[model samples]
Each structure stands twice: as structure tokens, then as C-alpha cells.
Target: MNPLYISQKLFEHYEHIEEVKHYYGLLAIYALLLTAEEKQDPVLLGKCKTVLSRFPDHIQHPRYNFPSYRIGGIPKAYSLMKDYLPEAEEQVRYYAEEMLTASRDRKGIMSYPYAPEKELIWIDVAMAVTPYLLFAGLALGDEKYIDEAAKQTFLMYEEFLDQENGLLHQSKNWAGPGKYSEDHWGRGNGWGYLPLAELVQHLPQHSRHRTKAEKYFKDLSASLLPYQSERGLWRQEIPFEYAYEETSGSGLILYGMGVGMRTGLLDREKYFPAFKKGIEALNQICINADFSTERSCPGCLCPGDGEEKGTVKAYVTLMLPHRDEHHSFAPLMFALVEAYRNGIYDLPRDSH
Candidate 1:
């Protein structure tokens, strides 16, 4: 039941290794964990600030990049600790400018705007920027940031969600209409879930916008439950039972569900079991300690044919998904913290 100890160990081990691209998301996780522990560990906080500061100037120069926007969530960590670390205020500003710019460029009148050809559109881009948007609004005391967040947030729900099934999808391709699978994809659902569960905390409860978002989130959590694998993990493709399960997606689900329960939006009696299953799967993955965690199904914005030569080529060349354990590690640890805090699982006595 010592979540603080477990979280500290998980974070320390990961921070020491510090593999490159994983840093931003993991720092976001650490920010959540530290805030939960109710102690401000400046060392971890400093490490987090260093990672966020380095992003705009990264050799890869993610500032204007689509994938770079994914780091937008990191500012939430800064916003959590900004009063203690005043310097983080500047980093939050820097990230907000870039993310808001991206959202505007991609926004259209009747539909969400697309980012050129290969670039990320609203769904993917919004997932990346949502954390920062919420943070900027609170940190700077700027209603504009919150208003923009609401507008962009609405765009994501408008375009990506499959109205019939009530689950969210990535996007529709430019050249042709896009197809969403019968079941939700784990990561996309994860992306959708977190913003609703966490960011909604900052919005005024009585506002019409928050009420709409809560309804959407409730439906999303309900829709995602049936897709949970018997083993407590979510498959890369929820409807495609044959596809592999991905740990990062599962962890994000746990984060979302746990946040839901914490906020009283999700009915714990109905949804807690699903959340528990998610944690059980995550704990197993951690105990397994596979270096790569579990391989994620390749990232594809569109569901492509496994058949055609061109489709296969596209899946191999463009949609080829790669998996790294770094993403899985931090989220798993964060979920563990949530589980412990919720007292969902009882730790057994030592086997010895």
C-alpha cells in the first residue's frame, strides 16, 4: 500500500536511464505522482523543467513539428508546480504559443483543418496540445486560452468521434473517406479520455461546455469497457481482437478512469472493475519487466488494408508502428499510484 515508495522507485529508475523521446510524457507522469505524494521534490521538478526547456530547442526542433505538439501535455506538470518553480511559467508560455498556432492553422470552418498531407490534424494535434492549453489558461489567468481550448476541444469531438458507436477515431483521410474500426483503438481512446477527465477539473462545473464534455466522456468510458481484454489489457485495435495489446494505451485508460472516479463523473460501482482490470494488466507488465514493455501496434491514422501491395507498402513505410518501453513505464507507474491511492488492490503478505 506504499504507493509513494513504489512511485519513487519507478520514477528514479526511469529518470536515471532517461531515453530521449520518452522524457516529456514521463516528466508529465512524474509531475502527477509528485503532486499526489503531497511533497515537492525539487530534484524531480528540476529534471522535469530541464526536459521541457530542451524541447523547443531540441536538435529535432519539435517547436513547430506536429508530433512535437504531443509534448503540450508537459506544461500541466509545470502548472502544477509553477508557484514553486517560477521559471516554468516561461516554458508554459513558449509551449502555448506553438500549440495555439498549430491549432489555428489546422482549424477550418465546417470541419477541423488538416495539416498539409503527412502532418497531424486536430485529433492528434489536440491530444498533444490539450495539456498545455489547460495549463496556459490557469497559469496566465487568460480567459482567451480557455476559450481557445474550448473551441479546439469541440473540433476534436466534432470530427473524430464515430457518432453511431460513440467512440472516437483518428481522422478522415484527405484523398478519401476514412474508416473507423468497430471497436475503439486503445491509444486514441486514451488520448480522448485524459483530456476529459483531467482538463475538465479546471473548467467551471456549471458551464454549458463542461456539461457537454462530461456527457461525451461518460459515453466514451462506457463504450470502451467491453473492449478490455480478458487478461486486463486493451488490444492495439479494440474491435480487431487479433491485434496486439499495448501497455501505454492501457495505462492511459487507467489514468482516465481513475481520474473519472476521483472527480465523481464516472460511477465507480459500474466502472471501477474495468479500471481495476487495467491496473492488473499493467502490474503484470511491470512485473514481467520486458525491456520493450509490450510492442505497440504501429501508429496509423487510418485503418489500412492488410491486403493490397500499396497498402502493405504504406503500412510498412508510412504506417509502420514502432514500440518502445519508455512510454509504457511512466504511465504504468502513475496508474499504480492511482490504484494505491484508490485502495483498489490489496497487497499480499510476503511469500517468504
Candidate 2:
């Protein structure tokens, strides 16, 4: 029941695969970086480097696909690997600058800002793209990147956040019949949550933006906590019986919560149990079940069709029949790492 042991199984599953080249690749690369950091293993770092090597200059690499801002985290992965590889810094700066310039030109949004169209803002992009924004800002002693991050973060918050429930919709529609999904998709919430937690993690502690981000984190945590089921996992549609408990949402939410606990961003008394409960749930659902991840929406554009109205029915029906979905792999491994880092719970076994 070693967490690392379990994580290795998931990592090895993606080790040789090359078909995925978008968010999955970006997430897998970031997950590998986190794994390398946690293990402090050169061999693991080398493995991460191998992933980066696949796209040598991510800035110009046609495959990396710029202006999506999914490419933001990719540069951080490159920067992290700089110690192990010589050209890492150059690559990091290049992509970071290019992504910033592209967003600037696009009026501060990803190229694929929304589903089935453009200029619309996806809630997930806050997490998908902002890490590098905050990171590059801090790394280069440039408030511009950090400022951009805060602007985008707050904009997404302004657009998608439902302050009434402290929940969020999937995307903001620039031009559409329906602006966004009606239901609060669990994984979508996770996407929003993780970025705020990440801002708390990476930004200067006393900065006004960090303080605001922390408040946002706590408020969202308060909002999301009630939805956790008796099984300690959140469902696809969140607190809805129509859909089953999902792994990717659970993992992303769990990772953010665990990191919040570790960083003191979340209240220990209120959240530790929730965090521990999530890990236990994951152990029961995924770790012991041959690393199976159930109920994952396997990487598709949500609300992709005009017919697929953003309803609870649409959400539950489409986000189903999950089995070994690779989309779940990164977040689960991420949660595993953060669980280890937080030390709230150990491996499922009595002894790791």
C-alpha cells in the first residue's frame, strides 16, 4: 500500500504512450515533475526529462499548441527540469513569454477559451494556464506575470463563480444560447479550486492577491465540503444521485485540500477529516481495485454540442462508464503526492 508504489503503477501506464498531446500530456508532465520532486530521484527526473524531450522547444513545437494556455504548466515542468537538463531555462522563458504575449493579444484568454468556439472563457483555464503565469512572474521578479495571473484568476472568478453556492460553471459563453452548464460539475469545480490553492502555494504570502486567493480557497472549501458523500467522495454532478462517485474530481479536489492542509491554507480541524476521508475513499475505490479510476469524463469538450444542453441529465449521462480513464491518472497521482506531503494519512496498509 505504499503511496509511491501505487503512483508508480499509474505513471508507468503513461510512460511509453504518445497518442495524447494536449492537456493530458501537460498534466502528465506536471505530475511527473511533482513525482520527481517528492521522490528526489534523479532517475525519476530523467524520466520527466524524457517527457519534455518529446517536444524540445515547446514554444515552436507545433504539437504543444500555444495560446491554449494549457501550455502554461508545461513551461514550469521545463523549468523544474533545468537542474537535470541544460536547455530547460531557455525553453521555460520562451514558452512563458510567448504564452503571455498570445494571451495579451487575445485580450487575455486562451485560444480555445471555450467549447465549440472561441473568446469564451473556460473555468478550467484558470488552473490550466495560470500556474506558469504566477510562476514566471515570481521567477523573473516580474509582477507582470503575477499581475496577469491575478487578472485572469479574478476574471474567471467573476464570470463562472456562483457566490450563492460558492460553486462554478464550466465555461462562460461569449455568444451562445446557454452561457454555461446549469449544474456544478464536480471536476470543473476542482479545476477552479486547484488554481486558487496553487496561487496560495506559489504567491507571496502577504501579497493582497494571495490573501484574496486564500479567502477564495476557504470559501470554496466551505462550499464544496457539504457535497462530500458518505463515501468521502464527490459525485460527477456533485451531491446528485443521478451520477456515481467520480475519481478525477475526487482526486483534484483531494489534492487541493491536502495541499491546503499542508500549507495551512485550510483549517486543520475542519478539513483534516475531509482530506483523510478522501484518501480512504480513494484507497477503497482505486488503490486496492487494481488502480481503477471510476466515473471519469475521458477528456472531451463539455457542452460540445448544441443538443447536449448543460443540464444535470446531460452531465450525469455523459460523464459516466468510467474505467481506467487516463484523465484521472494525473490528479490521482497528484493527490497521492500531496497526501504524502500532508502526512494526514499513510498508505492504506499498516506499514508502508
Global lDDT scores for all candidate models: 0.57, 0.69
Tens-digit lDDT string for candidate 2 (1-352): 6565567667676554434346755675677677777778778877776656656444443444354333335544335434555455555566667766653214455645224244655677777667767766666667777877777776676677776788887765533543666768888888888778778888786776877888788888888889898888888877576578888888889988987888887888999898888887876675434455555776533544565666677777765646667777777888888877877335664321
Instruction: Report the Cα lDDT for candidate 1.
Output: 0.57
The residue-by-residue lDDT of candidate 1 on 190-264, one tens digit each, is 777766765666676655568777877778888777788888877665556666667767777787777778788
Question: What lDDT score is found at residue 253 in candidate 1?
Answer: 75
TM-score of each predicted structure versus truth = 0.77, 0.86
Q: Using lDDT as the measure, which candidate wins?
A: 2
- Please give the distance, in angstroms, between residue 306's alpha carbon in candidate 1 and its true position after superposition: 9.5
Question: After superposition, which runs of candidate 1 have C-alpha atoms over 4 Å from their true positions?
Answer: 1-4, 16-18, 22-43, 46-73, 80-82, 103-122, 174-183, 206-208, 286-292, 303-323, 344-352
Model 2: residues with Cα > 4 Å off, grouped in runs: 16-20, 57-86, 103-118, 174-178, 288-292, 304-308, 349-352
lDDT of 2 at 86: 49
Clashing pairs in 2: none
Best by TM-score: 2
